[model samples]
Target: MGSAVLDIGGNTGALVVVTGPEWSGREIEISTKDQDPLARTRAAVRARHTGAGTRYTAVFPTLPAGPYVIWRTATEPAGTVVVAGASVTEIEWWQLP
Candidate 1:
């Protein structure tokens, strides 16, 4: 999962999904104080993934909150790779059923 820091004044969020060979589906969940566009997007991603039975979550820092994005990719021959920018907080990998 990958998360990006958002602009404090910004009010939009986005979620991304990438399906892989072993991945059947994904579930993502987000919690926020308000129903901002970004927050809603995060929630939607969570709902979709939850409905599919996958588990995912990405959280950003304060001030801007976040413009977080999450993705799932098929296991690569070289294994998984994660790249983060300066605004990123954490990145994780999981083996799916």
Candidate 2:
């Protein structure tokens, strides 16, 4: 986390997606909201064995500035994100309902 504010009109930024504790071994994806995605990243990491994780975190760097969403499989439990230049936007969601 930094002190810089989001530059809404700038070209790119970062997105951090955090999932609920029980989301181990699941695949998470990011897509531009209402817009076709320019790219997608596959996130797979488990935080269950430690027995103390608050959430599973996924970081997407240099994403185009705009609205996006985090989804797993069918996208039911998705959370939204906004990436503004040089800043990081966070989206937190629980396991699929």
Candidate number of the best lDDT: 2
Give the least accurate 10-residue stretch of model 2, judged by summed lDDT: 1-10
Q: Please write out the lDDT profile of model 1 over residues 9-96, one tens digit for every residue.
A: 3443232333332433344333333334244222222212444565444333332344332323221121222223333333343442
Whole-model lDDT per candidate: 0.34, 0.60
Pairs with steric clashes in candidate 1: 8-64, 12-38, 13-38, 20-74, 26-49, 27-49, 27-50, 28-46, 29-46
lDDT of 2 by residue, 41-97 (tens): 656534523345345666565677877766655645255666787677776665323
Give the clash count for model 1.
Answer: 9
